[model samples]
Target: MLVFAFQISRSGKSTYLQQVCLVVILAQIGCYVPARFATIRVVDRIFTRMGTMDNLESNSSTFMTEMRETAFIMQNVTNRSLIVMDELGRATSSSDGLAMAWSCCEYLLSLKAYTVFATHMDSLAELAT
Candidate 1:
């Protein structure tokens, strides 16, 4: 199932993602996840080991760094993989960023991967229809 969560910062959006990621990882490893009587079934390998770009002191432009990380994810993701992408393509111009974001979503759709993409780009919701 594709789930879209929209909320302001400091409203537990990131916390929610962290919880979900933890549960999925635990489930993948055959560990018990306490879910308040709800069963969480994870059927694929979780890829949550990726590092954030926030601490990296890269000489490359922000857009370039974003694209590099994005490309890495695209190369490694599978149909059953769960991807959590936060604020994708945010470093470029609005038009370029939106286009890149739209294209990335399109490619992810083609793969049928379960993705949780958090973004301020409201137009991206239109891609689902």
Candidate 2:
């Protein structure tokens, strides 16, 4: 889902996305979640793409590294997979990034995986409609 609130810019959305994935992980590991009404869907795998992730030692730019990771996710993720991508398309020019994000969103929607995508591009929220 596209988070629309401007106040969530302080990494709150990223944190929130992490919590959801963590809950599923905790549940899968047999840890009892203290929820009065919980129906956590069982998933095969969890993939995450944190925006600032980079492999500096390998001489890979953050954008290149993230692109490789994103490609891997698209290739490996399944309907039962859980995906959390934060600030996709932010490593390049704004227009380029938004274009990439837009296409990625379309692809992710087609896959029907449980996905949580967080971005600072407010225009992306329009895609929800």
1-129 per-residue lDDT for model 2 (tens digits): 223322356858877788888889989888988687788889999998886656888889889998998899989988888888888887889999999988888787777777888777877777778
lDDT of 2 at 116: 82
Q: Which stretches of candidate 1 lie over 4 Å from their true place?
A: 37-45, 48-58
Q: What CA root-mean-square deviation does each model show from the true structure?
A: 2.7, 2.3
Q: Over the stretch 77-122, how does candidate 1's per-residue lDDT look in tens digits?
A: 8888887766677787888888987887888889888887776788
Models 1 onward score TM values of 0.79, 0.86
C-alpha lDDT of residue 80 in model 1: 82
Report RMSD for candidate 1.
Answer: 2.7
The alpha-carbon deviation from the true structure for residue 92 of candidate 2, after best TM-score superposition, in angstroms, is 0.7
Q: Give all candidates' CA lDDT scores.
A: 0.72, 0.80
Model 1: lDDT equals 0.72
